[model samples]
Target: MSNFARVRPIGRRRDGRPIYPIKGGSPTLTEQRDEVMRLLQDENYDGDVAELLQRAERIAGEIELAQQREARLRHLRGLTPPGDPDPNPGQRQQPGNQPDNGIPDPVSAAEAFVRSEALRAFRERGLRGESGAVEFRAAPAGTVTTTTQPQQNTRVPGIIPQNPDFPLLVASLLDRQTSDGTTLEYMRDTSGPQSTWNKAAVVAEGADKPKSGPFTFDLISTSLKTVAHWVPITRQAADDNGQLMGYINGRLTYGLEYKMDREILTGNGTTEMQGILTTPGIGTYQPGSGSTDPKLITVRKAKTQGELALYPPTAVVMNPMDWQDIELDEDANGQFRVIANVTDPGAPTRLWGLVVVTTVAMTAGTALLGGFRTGATLWERQGITILMTDSHADYFTANTLVVLAERRANVAVHTPAAFVKITFAALP
Candidate 1:
């Protein structure tokens, strides 16, 4: 952030040529570096070449120290991951370890597995073809290389490892928890407070208190189910490309999330997670007979039903097509209705003051609005774990390996009334 001065010509040579030499003013480290460059390059510089050279050496040391300090600050502020420590002050990162392509080295889990002892042993004992695929190991971790100049102006490609994880839409909206057991047992209230909460009345003195019907509840026990998929790739691909390995792992994990998201809203209880729509006793909303209600109006009406049930809906889950219509819906003046900060993107998807999850998970012409974070919970028994094995179904002989990714999870809807499933259809 410091405004370092550019190098200025100090004086003129005897023949009137401009002469640039070290001057008295306090120059910035960068400016000092420029002075050093001038002293080395200019034959007519007045200062002593040897003493000035010594000062130049000190300036170089300062520049290196400054770079390391900046890197450390960036790490502390969470700009980038930490790198190997500098053993000595002002020393450059080791020559043989740094990458020529200027990418900061980050060890992803899949890459870690490839570099692990287990994979190495597998490579040694397992089959090989011709000279066999050589095991490729990434060089020692490199520090993030950045410059003070703007990215567009910097000559070196300033690259860093971007987070490869997917933005979980539905999963992120749900209340997620870790479970130790295979089955999750939770009580779902049927009557809740609406029908069974009128018992408490004002009773004076020793008058007998009126007893109302007890709130009904059903013991819901849902078993953790596995959602998984696998991909087959050659041993050569796995060993040679760590980035590819990470890419596969990230995508596989995302696949599990995608299915889980769909299941949370539509899965039949017998097979998978008990979806909110399929769960019994939840409120339902539909347009009146022969009444034409737009999606914007339909969502508001559904939200009111949830509120009337004494559960304020937190989010609305709709098919992308439905939301597309809503976003593009025009008023009488033809102005597009939903202005979602399109000019300044990255806004959270929202509608009617509730979070909107627009995914293919929900059936077209239908929507579900719910207090998902409170009405239901997602229990993850085992998170997404990736495993590669060449021993599956003669894959070992075929020189192929299967990368299996899976997770064990279940959904529990505690208060069914806290959700409302809307059928965007008119009574026929």
Candidate 2:
């Protein structure tokens, strides 16, 4: 009986495992507290706690690094990680391998589960033939010879094939060669041979008509060498008809007179030809008819002085008031004057007279005027001179005539005259 008998079961075991006997049938409170304290004070306690904390920290770091690496890889592939319900399933996990909370790859998964065969079965029901038949049978050969309606040609008209080897015949006609070694021209005539003739020839002629000559011809002539003159017309006279008409009439009459004088000078020898005088009042006048009064007139004089002293003299003209007084004296310092005189007579009296005397002046001790002249005379000049009167008149009437005459003369003088001939030969 002893101490074991005295220690009755402190706690009954439900499944036959006996409870502790210290301190009211449970392990004693002091002993439990002591065990907990002993565990806290154990030698490996700090090491175990440190190992657990390190393991937790490592797990957290690994999760964070894995998420970062996934994000980086997605970025490199030009993709973004999908949201919860992904729009692009192809960017996510595959079908069978998808996790419980994983998304699917949109492109690859859709291709894998496509229903193409089902769609084909649906289309077959609408066709005329049986579901799986391959050949189409023609209508039975003329049981009653029932004629089917004719069908129209669906091809577009006039679209000729551009075959490179042969020319396409558009139309054809019936005709033969004539006696003059020429085939009578007909519509739709094929180049090589005639077949499927659709046109009829109305008449059969001999040979083809001879081709006509060239449409243009050329004229051959020498170029008339002449000088051009530019004359300024006032704006007022250009706008006025009466003033332009009067100026043109006066200029023409004056031009003709100058031509006569030039011809006379040409008749005379070079040395014998002295300076010729041109007066302004030498125009035809009618009673009671109003005409433009001449205000200025230019006179060109041809003169021959002697030969050169030492060096040839350059030509120059001395200024003059009018043609009346010709100054023969030279300057004291020996500045030689080549041209004898250039005079612009005052208004009506001298009438803007310019005496262009051809003379060459030398600069040596005995200064002399040379008379060697080259080229055509100045009178053969082709030029236009526009004059303005104080009175206003329209430009089209008489002014147009004057302008045309001047232009014609200029063209005749400057243009080289040449003739062109064209030769055409018929092929045999």
Query: Which numbered prediction scores highest in lDDT against the true structure?
Result: 1
TM-score versus the correct structure, for each prediction: 0.63, 0.15
Residue 426 alpha-carbon offset, candidate 2, angstroms: 75
For model 1, the local distance difference test gives: 0.67
Error of 2 at 177 (Å): 64
lDDT of 1 at 304: 84
How many collisions per candidate?
A: 0, 18
lDDT of 2 by residue, 201-311 (tens): 454488454433222222313222221222334534433433433333344323432333332222222222212111111111111224221111111111111111111
Residue-wise lDDT of candidate 1 within 218-253, one digit each (tens)?
998779998879887787776654433544445665
Candidate 2 TM-score, C-alpha based: 0.15
- Model 1 has how many clashing residue pairs? 0
Q: Please give the RMSD to the true structure for each candidate, in Å.
A: 17.7, 51.5
Reference-based lDDT, each prediction: 0.67, 0.26
At residue 95, what lDDT does model 2 achieve?
Answer: 28
